[model samples]
Target: MLYTNITSINHFFITGFPGLSLEHYGIVSCLLLVLFLAIVFGNMFLLVFVKCESSLHRPTYLIFCHLALTDLTFGTVTLPKIISKYWFDDSIISFYGCFAQMYFIHLIGAAHSFILMVMALDRSIAIYAPLRYTVLFTNTSASVLCVISWLLPTSWMVGVVLDALSLPYCNSNIIVQCYCDHIAITSLGCENVRDVHIVAFGLAMFSLLVPLGFIIISYFIIIVAVMRISSAQSRIKTLSTCTPQLLITFLYYMPRCFVYLANNVGFTFSVPVRIVVVMLYSLLPAAVNPIIYCFKTKAIKDSLKRKFLVRKVNIRTKT
Candidate 1:
């Protein structure tokens, strides 16, 4: 039964792809499911590889582990809801449930962004001050920074969620996209959402743009420093370490920027276009992270082989 508050909006109208056929939804469902699996399995391998390999117990890998965890959490927060919408004929999320979804989405999203910034700083220190990298990004320091990264975004999300919920919602409650995105939800509010938009935009810029700017600056310095190194091998090695981070930064930032720009400018792109953009923003990073990092690092490859091959051999012997 749909819950209704007499004074508030009784039901939300979700404005999904009106012209999208069942065949299209099926294709999208299969692709999304595959992507979700890849994200989960890939991130799982990363976490396991880090845990099993004692040699990988450096501050850099520690931060990488946290980043993978964030990606996994972020993927889990949205992908299930998306899959549900695609698989079920009638999918509806309760008000509180939608709020919770948005909260976690922002929390993990912010954590992921902050971790990327931390990773940039880590790389910069490693490149520019190799001697101090250990002392600076120590285990204690990494722990503190990781905790702060998780907490800071969570705090910001709580404030945003509270403020958003306070606004009166009229008959328009249905979210346009699969999940409860802040921008989509804000558009449904009956009350003036100018203040909400301002606050949300401020938070988004702080979390996304500011860190992105720092990453760009850090990479610029790192690149220049790499060029100064005379040895070809050293230059290649330095660039390799930063490459994975750079790829992730681009994957995350570009789509996010597009989404924010589209929302702010009130661009009336088709629902399918917006859906594709949102899916790419949400899924691609998760799908790419493990593949990029694991393939780049021989150590991770060896760990995966050992973990898988050893288990296979043991199973054969048991059989």
Candidate 2:
């Protein structure tokens, strides 16, 4: 392997798993197909269900709808090309195509983080100021926040994407990770990418930590408020309402921060372990969110039963 640069290598090969054998590619592909379908149907169903159900048109449900869209987009941006790579051995992604993928991956990822923070804020407000929650957080307000979540990340990621794009890539066009992302692309650059990564890291930290900080504070206030309740049953009941979101939030944040921190500080992970960790945190939250965040709600559960079971029984009786 002589060091001759491809000067303008138009495509980068996605190494599905650097360590995994080609024989196992299909198996991983099948699993990813399942996860992708789950993410698609799960989030899409919630969005469609929200649209069709008049009862679910409120700000609370709108927040979840925003999250559903974010998760849906996140999975779509990362999954298909990788699935194609694993299943069909089509690993080539054009320079701009990779750029688009990298851009959206970071943007959607940041949006998801901020959206989760919004959800935490929504919960906090409801728990801490029940009476004022309705007044303080309205449909208009939630909608605005949702728009901001999608837009705010756009500005932060654009510079990073542009920096990576401008840099000259060498002969090797192999991306270590499953997808084209800021870090993956920057690492391929022939330039000194330390500053770019640092800037990206700073922006990433701000996007993650600011919202995370708020969520933590919001939860703290919420916990304090919950504890003040005199009835043990009521306290348990209130905390029960929060468990699902808290669970998803933990899944969303902790692993991502760990991976980011590891990448920046030069913490070494086996390639397989690193990719698997990335995929789990990235995809699992999206896949499980519909179940944990949406369907777990009593209203949605009852609606499901009415829409399916009741309708089935009615048809049977009519027949």
Candidate 3:
């Protein structure tokens, strides 16, 4: 039954990809397994690399460290249940568990947006206020920003959690999506949710769009500053440093905004298509973030290369 009663609806069945048949389960499961492993290993490698290499303890790299940690925790909080749904055929989640998942998902997501905004500020300070950058964004300030990043998200999403909890979910227990999300869960409320929808969506957009706007403005200033540099080589060097951040920011925001629009605005898409878009935005960044940094940032690439070379020499010596 979709919903038996407020108390009775204790568990939810997660039917992933309504479009896929039983035959597609193996392929989908294998793919998700690969992505999960990559997200875990890639983010872990970046975190350890930053920690062991004291040279990367600068303000910007410290922010990168935070981003890496968020990505790791994001996947940890979200992916296992998704993987289990496919691999072990475990699709049921308890009521409290569902609310908890919803909270963490938004928590991580909101924190991520704020972290990216911080990164953009870091880049801007580096470019626009090069001399004052160090003094401005000292190790202490960076740590504070990191703390605020998590705290702000936690505070913001508390309302979302309360909103979900306040609603008596006696209408439907079936969440069409793969995981517990605010929209999907609240939709099952027995009462009319137009006000709830407005408030919930308003909070969601405020959290997402506000940071996004700051990022855009920061990048705009950074771009103008970059263009003012006279030397071609200097401009190239400055832009190269920003490429990884730019790519990751694009990966994070564009698809998310698109998904939001498709759902809210008049844009129409089939259920499976909508789910694919959502999953792409949801999963792609966690997988691509570390890869983008490894490719774009010389420090990260060089660090990994040095690690590999040292490992190779150690193996030879042992042999």
Best lDDT among the predictions, by candidate number: 2
- Give the per-residue lDDT of model 2 (tens digit) for 1-319: 2234667777788886777898888899999999999999999999999889888777878988998998999999999999999999998899899999999998998898898888898889889999998899998999899899999999868888887888888767888889997888888888798998888888888888999999999999999999999999999888877887888789888888788688779998888788888888888999999997665676777777778998899999999
* Model 1 ranges with Cα > 4 A deviation: 1-6, 10-16, 258-268, 305-319
The models' CA-based lDDT, in order, is: 0.81, 0.87, 0.85
Error of 3 at 198 (Å): 1.3
lDDT (Cα, tens digit) per residue for candidate 1, span 16-51 = 555668777777667778988988998988888788
Compose the digit string of candidate 3's lDDT tens values, residues 1-319: 4557545577877877886887878889899888889889999988888888988888778888888888888788777887898888898999899989999988888888889999999899989999998888898898799879889878768877897788777667788887888888888887787787888778778779998999999999999999999999999899888888999899999988876777678888887887777777887799899998887888888988998999999999999
Question: What is the full ranking by lDDT, best candidate first?
Answer: 2, 3, 1
| lDDT at 77, model 1 | 81
Name the weakest run of 10 consecutive residues (lDDT summed) in model 3.
Answer: 1-10
Write down the RMSD of all candidates, one decimal each. 3.2, 1.9, 1.8
Candidate 1: what lDDT? 0.81
lDDT-wise, the better of 1 and 2 is 2
